[model samples]
Target: MADAQATGPILQLQGVQTHIGPYHILHGVSFEVPRGGVTMLLGRNGAGKTTTLRTIMGLWRASAGTVTFDGTDITRHSTPAIAQAGIAYVPENMSVFSDLTVAENMRLAARTGAIDERRLDWVFRMFPALKTFWHQRAGVLSGGQKQMLSVARAIIEPRQLLIVDEPTKGLAPAIIQNMIHVFRELKQTEVSILLVEQNFHMAKSVGDTVAVMDDGRTVHTGAMAALAEDDTLQQKLLGLSLAAHQ
Candidate 1:
């Protein structure tokens, strides 16, 4: 096995294909998420972005190809096994236990049995709303607050990689800005991030590298700065200018 910590992609997908029942979702999708930076997965709707993420998590098993994480092949691993291998996934739906209190939710995410006070404090600092409603039930929280809780859960415990989908969707401009700042700070940590986002402002703000999918396969892969600087490349790959999206 290669040493992911030394130099190389923390996560790599090669010729990956997935089938959801009878429907083929991903067709030879390939990309890489560098060891400790944010990688943006960009594509229009129904281009299989979400399916690719689900496939990585083992929620939807791939019919063919490989998903290598931290130098081990996780393509056939169960969801629990994959998670135990140090990957945390936050889906687009902002999945949170509605019946559980914020504190309880965080406690469950701790995974090692007890929540670390310092880590909890760190999470609180990143998202103060969770601290403000520590004992409050998640069901009663507003959408934006729920989104924060979802992210807080993913980061509460240490992991090698963090995967999030459309985290800024439906969030207010201020909330989105806060999320951008949080992601920026997260880059300083050891965890690598693979983010799927349609909001180019957030993507361009924090993405060190980017991969654009089209019809279930990655069509373009390059530095985010390169994509940001070239309007023609952005238009050619994404069908719109990243600058115009903001």
Candidate 2:
């Protein structure tokens, strides 16, 4: 295997295709997630953004093409194997164990079978509410708090790549701002992130680069600043102006 650190992209997809049963979802999707920054996956509804994330995570295997992670081909790897390779995924649903306490839910996410105190402390610093409700059941938490717990679980240990889908979908404005802050801080740790978000403001604020998907294929890829600055390009790819979303 090549040295991952020497490679520029932590994750790369090339001509990736996925089919959910008989329905073809991802048709030759391709993109790259740079080594140490947030990469936003942006598109309109039914654009296969979530499908792309799932394919990368091995929840849905790629029927064709390749998903290379830090120089490894992971397209055919199992979900657990993909995770073991140091990629953590937080799906759009924020799938926390509703019956479990915050602590229990977190404990389950730790692959080492026990949560490291130092890393737990880091998670607490990013989300104080999780610390406050350590013993509370996950189901009883508010929407935004649940989202935080989901993210905290993914980062309870070190990971090379973090893939999150639609994190700001229904979050309140204040909570969205908090999430933006958390993402910014996480990037400082040199963890590469592939984030799928509909909130253009949050995407623009935290994203260093972006890949825009449309009709199950990647149509555009470039610097996030470039997309944000060009209203005409934003309209062409995303079908909406970033300024209007602000």
Task: Report lDDT per candidate.
Answer: 0.93, 0.94
lDDT value, candidate 2, whole model: 0.94
For model 1, name the residue pairs that clash. Answer: none
- Report lDDT (Cα) of residue 175, candidate 2: 95
Q: Candidates' TM-scores? A: 0.97, 0.97
On lDDT, the candidate that comes out on top is 2
Please give the distance, in angstroms, between residue 85's alpha carbon in candidate 2 and its true position after superposition.
0.5
lDDT (Cα, tens digit) per residue for candidate 2, span 124-210: 999999999999999999999999999999999899999999888899999999999999999999689999999999999999999
How much is the lDDT of residue 216 in candidate 2?
100
| lDDT tens per residue, model 1, 1-246 | 345346878999999999988998899999999889899999988999999999999999999999999888999999999999999999999989999999988889989759999998998888999988999999999899999999999999899999999999999999999999999999999999999998899999999999999999999998998998999988888899988878
> Model 2: which ten-residue window has the lowest total lDDT?
1-10
Error of 2 at 138 (Å): 0.9
